[model samples]
Target: MKKILLTVFAITFFINAKAQSAEVAITKKENDTGKIYTSVEKAPQFPGGIQSFYHYLAATIVYPVDARTKNRQGRVIITMTIEKDGSLTDIKVVRGVSPSIDQEAVRAMSACPKWIPATQNGLPVRVLYTVPIAFTLGK
Candidate 1:
């Protein structure tokens, strides 16, 4: 009967939807490349802790002499790819600024110290994460 078929279809649809929880959906983060995040497994830290990575970078960045933005201020959006073993695999610039400033941003990123590592389900999984750093001259 048409009524019986429609009822069965509706029930099946709901069952399938419930089975596939919304939270379990494979979410492609800003720059997801099918990578996971590393877990905390006790690693060495920079001289003054993980925060030192920023300090070291700020000290190394050299603004371009011809930078149009006299303010010399912009944000560098960095997307980092971490391996399961807690190491940097790839670094990409998502939202980039001027070419000159962008290059400096990449240099600073490459010079960054090891991260504290990220985790998923309490296990070390490679993942891609985006981090933004604002650079202001003489700030």
Candidate 2:
């Protein structure tokens, strides 16, 4: 009976440790002057929320003619810093399928309007945000 109890306690401790570790996996970065967080108390948002953001992307992203002709299709991953004033900067492609498509993705993201800006401890803060844009050719 004592052995069984010990084993159960050990299992519970490990389970709790695993859960805490998962929670700690959220990315956060800080600096002396300006801090950039990937996970914050409140995330930056588009003016009209996520659906509107997608709509904006759809309306803005024009498939590159060269890429379409070359049958280039894939998702382009982009990362940008959302400033305290909700402006986006440091826009770049983390992953790309082709040059034209990559450039188009950057163009679309760069043209987006200001976001709501992320918050930490109830004050506006800059955050690094990543977005993936997909380019698919119709069948």
Best by TM-score: 2
Model 1: worst 10 consecutive residues (lDDT sum): 13-22
Q: Residue 122 in model 2: shift from native, Å? A: 0.3
The CA lDDT of each predicted structure is 0.53, 0.72
Predicted structure 1, TM vs. truth: 0.59
- Local accuracy of candidate 1 as per-residue lDDT tens digits, 35-97: 442322232233575335445654666667766456556666877665555566578887777
Q: How displaced is residue 7 in candidate 2, in Å? A: 50
On lDDT, the leading prediction is 2
